[model samples]
Target: MILDKEVQRKLKIEPIEGSYNSYAVQEREKKDWRGNIYLACVAAILAISFFT
Candidate 1:
């Protein structure tokens, strides 16, 4: 699974050959942790505006 591939990468383990490109370094670069943190902050702001 792609999750395993990503986890392995984060843990510095080598993934098996012939896996899909979902976790390729180039593609994952755009969707890194910083991007996720930004998205989370945006979502929190939207939720706050909606509720209060």
Candidate 2:
């Protein structure tokens, strides 16, 4: 099946070789402590807002 130019342009194409590097980056992002803190703060704010 042939894909339209617009559809092809919008599609995200990644190389198989880059998949490993992308996985490593994702792993590093998962280990970010600052993200955890930010999430906790947001949760606390939401909880407080709901309660009060």
Candidate 3:
């Protein structure tokens, strides 16, 4: 498959290794409490909708 020039350019460019690692670590350390609550609400809604 052929890639676009822009995509090729982006793929060839490398981010700073240390900064990339730290950014990934920071992202992993962050929590999404609202997302968890939203998922729980959706699960509860589905359970009630189907089980009742």
Clashes of each: 0, 0, 0
Global Cα RMSD, each model: 12.0, 11.1, 9.7
Per-residue lDDT for 1-52 in model 3, tens only? Answer: 7665543221233355756443222222336599899999999999999998
> What are the TM-scores, per candidate, against the unseen true structure?
0.40, 0.40, 0.41
Question: Candidate 2 vs candidate 3: which has greater lDDT?
Answer: 2
Worst 10 residues of 2 by lDDT: 21-30
| Cα misplacement distance, residue 26 of candidate 2 (Å) | 16
CA shift of 48, model 1, Å = 0.3
Q: Which candidate order results from sorting by TM-score in descending order?
A: 3, 1, 2
Give the runs in model 1 whose Cα sits over 4 Å from its true position: 1-31
Clashing pairs in 2: none
Candidate with the larger TM-score of 2 and 3: 3
lDDT of 1 at 39: 97
Query: What tens-digit string does per-residue lDDT give for candidate 2 at 1-52?
Result: 7666543223344445645645222111225598889999999999999999
Model 1, 1-52: lDDT tens digits are 4665544233334455688643423222335598889999999999999999
- Point out the worst 10-residue segment of candidate 3 by lDDT: 21-30
- Relative to the unseen true structure, what is the C-alpha lDDT of residue 24 in candidate 2, on a scale of 0 to 100? 21
Candidate 3 clash pair list? none
